[model samples]
Target: MTQFTPDLASRFARIALGHVERRYPFKLDQVLLGPDDRRSPTELHPVFHGSFDWHSCVHGYWLLARIGRRFPDLPEAAEITALFDRKLTPELVAGERAYLDRPLSGGFERPYGWAWLLKLAAELEQRMAPAERAWAEALAPLAQAFADRFRAYLPKATYPVRAGVHSNTAFALRLALDYAEAVKDQDLAALFRHKALAWYGADADCQAWEPGGDDFLSPALIEAALMARALPAGAFVPWLDRFLPRLAAQEPGALFAPATVSDRTDGKIAHLDGVNLSRAWCLREVAAALPVGDARRGVLGKAAETHLAASLPHVASDYMGEHWLASFAALALETA
Candidate 1:
């Protein structure tokens, strides 16, 4: 399994810091109202206005926070600290909160960015540094706002989004659960458990018809990972058997192979690299959750390595991929 080393940490940190505030080449997720609402990305999303889009920028910060915590002596640590100190302020957080108040803002980044914000807060909380803690404190309101969104939305989310894209519910719920567990939020954790069971408990025989052109997530694998976290080991094994019945044979060929990216410069096509990285992490997580002697464990582990090898080198291949891919790469390597 690939590990996150100081050199890799510096590489990812530099990528994140380089774009967190770049402010250009951005795609804003907003509901414009007249000319006044047609504003620049920074004007609309004060804190998350870089890395091509809101969710990317949000996770970019998450990557920096996570890497800085793990490798405190890295050269990028000081800059990461300074960046958080400057950006994660009460005023900026308030500004970010206010944006959610706008019309049609409920769907802005929806569960994806919302999940990353909570993940960022959880990372800072885990680090337990006074300065980092202060940054997390300042970002608490924003995190709470997202948590409230999840609480309000999940009850009404009658169907789970199985897309291999940003709207995927399993991916968001998994990240949110991490934050909930880290903060010891019993209410939030209960909500996640309820929703996970409600959404996926009856699921079986995943087709794994995935790797959509622009997909950066494996809907099948993400759901499996969520079940791994949400269910007890004994229950999870049965669930996994029902959901991926042929995993022992690796019958779903898509699950074991790495996705190919035809164009790294094309934003949508570039997502294949992310797909590989995220699939790597999800596969590794699923493997870890299985019984030690399970035959599927070895298959999943090898598939993870294959996927990691396919995408790890392309993380910084182009500006389009570089702006966001490092974070997913870090996720894959660190989780392994």
Candidate 2:
């Protein structure tokens, strides 16, 4: 199985470094209230202005931070430190917070970007290295902004977004749970767990209608992963047994197959590559929650290896996937 080796860490860090601040070829998710709202990515987002979109840029920082933590001696650590010191400042983070306060901005990046921002904050808060600690301090208000959004939004989310794209709620919630767990925010954790259970509880016999043409996530697996993260072993195991009743047989096999990306240069089609990678991440997470003697563990583990093989090599092949795929690769490898 592919591992989070220093060589892979260096490569992932290099890919993130290449584009965290590349301001062009950008896609803005802004609510233009007036003429003055028309602005460049850098102007609108002081810290996150690259990697194609705000959410991608956020996770790009997360990829660098996570790799830097795991491989502290990496040559890229200096550049990562320099970048965080220069950009992740109180003033810049406040600009990001200001964006959230704008009129009609309630949906700006919504749950997806909101969740990624918290995950980045969680990575920074895990250690007390001077740079990491300072970055964490600089970013606290913005992270709070997102966490507050979650607290406010979940009450009215009535239904979860089950799409396999950025709108997917399960993916966002699972990422947010990591932040909640890291910070020991029991209230936050309780809120997220309640929301997840309310949305997914009693779900059984997943049909696994998945691999949506432009999907970057496996809807079925992400739901399973979120439930695994939210519930206890005694509760989750039985729930999962009913959810994927034929897991031992690999039924609903759309999930076991890696998505095929015929055109990596097309931004939407490139999402299929992300599907392979993010699936690897989710598969491992679900497998980890299973009992050691379960046959599904080996099955899920092998599917994860196949999915990683399918996309890990293509992470840096094109600017489309190049802008963001390495982050997913890091998630999969680090989890593995």
Q: Where does model 2 exceed 4 Å of error?
A: none
Best by TM-score: 2
Give lDDT tens digits, candidate 2, residues 70-114. Answer: 898999999998999999999999999998899999888888899
Q: Which residue pairs clash within candidate 1?
A: none
TM-score of each: 0.98, 0.98
lDDT per residue (tens digit) for residues 263-324 in model 1: 99998999999999999999998999988899989999999999999999998899899999
* Model 2, residue pairs in steric clash: none
lDDT of 1: 0.90
